[model samples]
Target: MATYDWLFSTLGLEQWCGASGGSAPTSLSDLAAQSRGETGEQAVDIWELPFPSMDALNDACPAFPQSRELTLGLEEGFLDIKDTLSVVLDPITQPLSWALDAALYGILNTPWWIVIPLLLAITWAVSRSWGLLAFVAACILGLAFIDHYDYAMQTLAIIFVCAFICVLFGVPIGIGMSRSDTMQNATIPILDMLQTLPPFVYLIPLIFLFSVTEPKLYGIAIILYAIVPVIRLTNLGIRMVDKNVIEAADAFGMTDRQKLFGVQIPLALPNIMAGVNQTIMMSLAMVVIASLVSAPGLGVLVLRGIRNLELGVGLVAGLGIVLLAVILDRVTKASLARINATHKA
Candidate 1:
C-alpha cells in the first residue's frame, strides 16, 4: 500500500485515471462494462477483472499454441474425449457415481437410522482397527446426529474416487521418474505448477474448458491438485534406497529392471505410501473446493451452510471431514509402518 501510494503521488500517474485532466462522464462506466464483458447488453459493470495485454503477452512467447482443440473440447468434447473417457473410464466412474447418487438419494430420502451405522461400519471395516473403527464411527454418528450426513457422503465420494485414481496414476509416473533423470527433470516443473498453485486456481481454466455438469471436470482438477506429492515422494523414495542394497543386487548380475523392482521399489514403498497418504489428504482438501464447481461432498454441505447461514450444519459437516481425514491418515500410516517393520525384521 505504501509503495503504491508513493508511486501514485510521486509520478503523477494518477492522471492516467483522469482526476484532473482526464476524467470523463462515462469513462469508468465504459471501462467497467468492458471489464464485465458487457457489449451492447451482456453483463453489468465489473471492473475488477484483470486485463491481459494481448500484444505484450504474445510478444514474450510468440508461438502460442492454437487452442482449437481446447475450444472444441469445451463445445462438444476434444477429439471425442467424452466418448473416449466414457469407454475407458466409464466402468470406474459409473460405479462411483452410482454410489454417490445412491448415497445422496439415500441420505435425502431415507431415514438417519440407516445412514449413520452404514457410514460408521464401512469406515471402521476399511481401517481394520478397533480404535480407529470406533473413532471413525463416533465421527460419523456425531455428524449424523448433528444432521450433516449428506454433505459428508458427498465429500467421501470424491475423496475415495480421486485418491484411488491418484495412486493408480501417480505410482507408475513416480516409478518412471525414479528410473530416469530425464523423466524426473521433465515432470518436475509440471508437478511444481500443479502443487504450488492455489487450490481455487485449478478451477479457472478448467471452467473455460468444461462445464459443471461433467464428472470429469472436477475429477481432473482433483487428480492434478493431489498428484504432486505421490510422484515426488515416489521418486524420492526410490532414489533414497541404500546404495549397498542396489550394489548387492548388481553383484547378483541383475538388470536395472530387476534391481528397481526387487530392491529399490520395495525399499521405497514406505515413502511411496507416505506420498499416497499426502495425495489422499490433498484430494480431500481439493474436493471441498471442487464442490464449488459441483463436485459433491461434505464441501457442498459446508457451502450450503455458508450460503444459508446454517451454522450447525457447517460445523457438523466440517467435523465429519476431520474424522474422515484422521481415519485415512492413520490407516495409511499404520499400513506403511507394518510393511517397513516387517522388512526390517
Candidate 2:
C-alpha cells in the first residue's frame, strides 16, 4: 500500500486511487520487492516510510502529470520563441561582433615594438607618472618574454571593445537615473539582478539565442556581466555632487546642460573613473568565462589546461591574467588620482 492510500480511500477517492477495481494499486516499492522475489510484507518497514511520489501517483492515475513534463514544457516553450528572438536581436547585435573581430585582428597583427611603446606613452599621458609608465612597460615586456603576448593582447582587445561599449551606454543610463527618481526606482531592480546573478548564467540564454561561433555571443555576455558597476557608480557620482556647487552654477545663470557637463560631470569624474576601473576588472573576469563560447585569449589556455589536466599551462596563463589585471588596475587608479587632484586644484 502507498503512504497516501488510507487518506485517498477515506476521502472516497478509490477510483482515483485505482482501488475501485477491487484491489489497491501497489506502490513502486512493492513492485520492486516483488521483482526481487520478496513480498511486500517482508520489505515494508515502519521506520522507513514509503513516500508517495509523482511516479506512484501516476501509476494510480495515468492522467496525472509528472515532474519531468514540467521541465520538458519549459524547454519547448523557449525553443518555440527562440527563432523570433534571434530575428530581432541578431541585427541589433551584429555590430558588436564586427567590433570584436576587428579589435582582435588589429591587436594580434600589430608588432610588439609598436604596441608596447604606444601603451607606455598612453600610460604616461594619463597618469603623468614615470613610475607607472615603467611598471606597465615591464609587465607588457614580461608577457612578451613568456610568449604569452599575443594571447594577452587578445584578452585586452576584447576588454577594450566591450568596456568601451559598456561605458558609452552605461553613463547615459546612469545620468538618466540620477536626474529622475522614477527612472532610478525602475532601474535599480534590473541593476541588482544583473549584479547578483552568477557569471555562467549570463551565457546560457545567449548560447541558445546565437551560435557559439559568433563573436557577439561572448561579447554580449561580457558586457552584460561588467556593465552594472559603471552604471551604478556613474549615477552615484553625479547625484553625490554638492548641491551648493549646483546652486552656484545656477546663480551664474547656467542651464541644466552647462551645470551637468561643466559642474556635475567634472566633480563626478573621480567616482566615474573608479567605476571604469571596476568595470575593466569585471570585464577581464568575464572575458575568461566568455572563452567557453570561443572568446579567444589567455582564457582559452586556462580552459585547455583544465580540460587536458595540464597544470603548468593553466598556471602560466593564470599568471599572465594576474599581470594583466594589475596593469589595468594601476593605470586606471593613477588616472583617477590625477582627476581628483585636478578637481581639488
Global local distance difference test of model 2: 0.87
Q: Candidate 1 at 327: error in angstroms?
A: 2.0
How far off is residue 279 in model 1, in Å?
0.8
lDDT of 2 by residue, 130-210 (tens): 888888988999889989999999999999999999999999998999999999999999999998999898898899999
How many clashes (backbone atoms < 3 Å, residues ≥3 apart in a chain or on different chains) does model 1 have?
Answer: 4
Residue 274 of model 2 has an lDDT of 90
Query: Candidate 1 on 182-299: residue-level lDDT in tens?
Result: 9999999999999898978878766655556766678878989998999999999999998888888989999988887888888998899899999989988887788888877788
Ten contiguous residues minimizing lDDT sum, candidate 2:
17-26
The whole-model lDDT of each prediction reads 0.71, 0.87
The C-alpha stretches of model 2 lying farther than 4 A from their native spots are 1-30, 33-64
> Model 1 lDDT vs. the true structure?
0.71
The C-alpha TM-scores of every prediction are 0.67, 0.87
| Candidate No. with top lDDT | 2
